[model samples]
Target: MSITVEKFVEEGRDPFSLEVVAGHEYLGRIIKEAALNRPGLALAGFFQHFAHLRVQVLGLAENAYLKSLTPDERGQRLHRLYQKKIPCVVLTRNRQPSSEILECAEAFKVPILKTPMITNRFINLATLLMENLTAPLVRYQGTMLEIMGIGVLMEGQAGIGKSETALALIERGHSLVSDDLTVLRKDSTGAIVGYADDMTRYHMEIRGLGIIHVPSLFGVASMRREMHLDLVVRLERFDPKKEYDRTGLNSETISILGADVPLLTIPVAAGRDIAHVVEVAALNQKLKQLGHDAAKELDEKLVRALERKRRM
Candidate 1:
């Protein structure tokens, strides 16, 4: 998952207003480190233990130091830092690069970026963006919806009614996250976040109908851009020959991006209300989160009763 300086600049353009100030042709520079480096010590001629692989951020204080130094000394320091082979440099507060620094950037072929954001804020957001870019992601054919604050991924084969189930949930006041396809990513907090692709966000397709914009038909509140995944509902065709779990004693789970998510397989059948069942499942998941597991509690109670009878 190596991220290049060019990709970082393009992705951060909208949030950080990042733009290349120098080394345009050398944009292919790979960012070995996902973190930022404040080169205050490097600028002051300290080379020991320098993070040369990280992106160097030149903030106001570093600019001030450069202003205080003579031309020859400034060029010496910039050349020394560039000689260390840093991946790139970022000038914060929209600071103009010094001729000495620009010369070093060109000579070393190190990409230099500039942003109008404050030093600390830009560093924070840029670090976050880097994390997002490198986060573990998985895409699946499914419809995701937020029902009563619970994120649910409805997965099944084609014509299994995932989109239709999502539509029904929408009619019942639930918000649609994504339809037909959902992308899940693990965030820094170790939770899976499900979201729709940019082009298909807030849109759905029905069997006989064409594509429909979710918010336009159901109002703005009926659509959600993303949500923390809490449950996964797998819809399958109901067959009388197959046996299904009648007792909720054994809970099933599926791994998504290394995290075990609660899984429920609901058999699709005539007159079966899947949307209502999924909504209840979501509420049950919420209860489990609050430390109340009905199935486990009942199983425990039955075990205690049988033990007492055997003792008697």
Candidate 2:
């Protein structure tokens, strides 16, 4: 998940209020770690336990310390900080870089970036940005929906009426996350979130309907930009030979970007209300999450009754 300094700058320029101060060409320096470091100790000539792999931050204290030093000592200390092979240096509070800081950065080929945000706020914001930039991501072929708070991923053959079913669910008050394609990413919480690409977000392509916007037609409540993937439903043409799970006792699951999610193989046939069935499935999944398993409870009750009959 390492990113180049250039990547961080490009992605964080507006948010971080970043402006290149020195070593413009050195923006390509690789960021081996996503954490930030304050070089106060290093600037004071204490190199022990220096976080050389992180992006160096020069806040007010460090800047003031440099201002107190003689020009010769300032240049020497700045040179030492850059020589530690740090990814880059960031000055918070939009503090102007001293001549010595600029000279040392260019001499050692270390990029210097400054942000107008305060030191503590900049650190927090940059931390989140780095984590998001490095999170594991994957692209899936499916229609994503949020039905009654449950995130469902409807996957199947391209023409198995996924968009049609999504439309029905939208009418039933469910929200659409994506149509035809979903981009999944494993966040820091170890949850899989499904989102749509910007190119066709909130747009569904029905066989004869061509392309239609969900939010525009059904109102904004009918569409969601992203939702955590709770269940996966695979739709297929009904085959009499195939044995479907009539009882919910045997649960199936699929892995999305390393997170295991419940999977259901739903048969699509004439006269079947797929939307109603999927909605029920989503509610059932929610019940299971809340520690209510109707199938298991019924089986347990039946077992207890059989045990009593045997004793009699």
- In candidate 2, position 118 carries an lDDT of 90
**Top model number, TM-score:** 1
lDDT of 2 by residue, 1-312 (tens): 789999999989989878898888899999998889998999999999998988899999899899999999998988888888899999999888899877878788899899999999999999989888888989899999999999999999988889899999999999999999999988889999889998999799999879998888999999998999999999999999999999889998997777889999999999999999999999999999999999999999999999999999
Each model's backbone clash number = 0, 0
lDDT of 2 at 101: 78
Per-residue lDDT of 1-312 in model 1, one digit per residue for the tens? 668999999999999999998899999999988889899999998889999888899999999999999999999999999999999999999999999989999899998899999899998998889988989999978899999989999999999899888999999999999998999999999999999999999889998998998898999999998999999999999988988888877789999999999999899998999889999999999999999999989989999999999999
- TM-score per prediction, in order, is 0.95, 0.94
List candidate 1 segments past 4 Å from native. 309-312
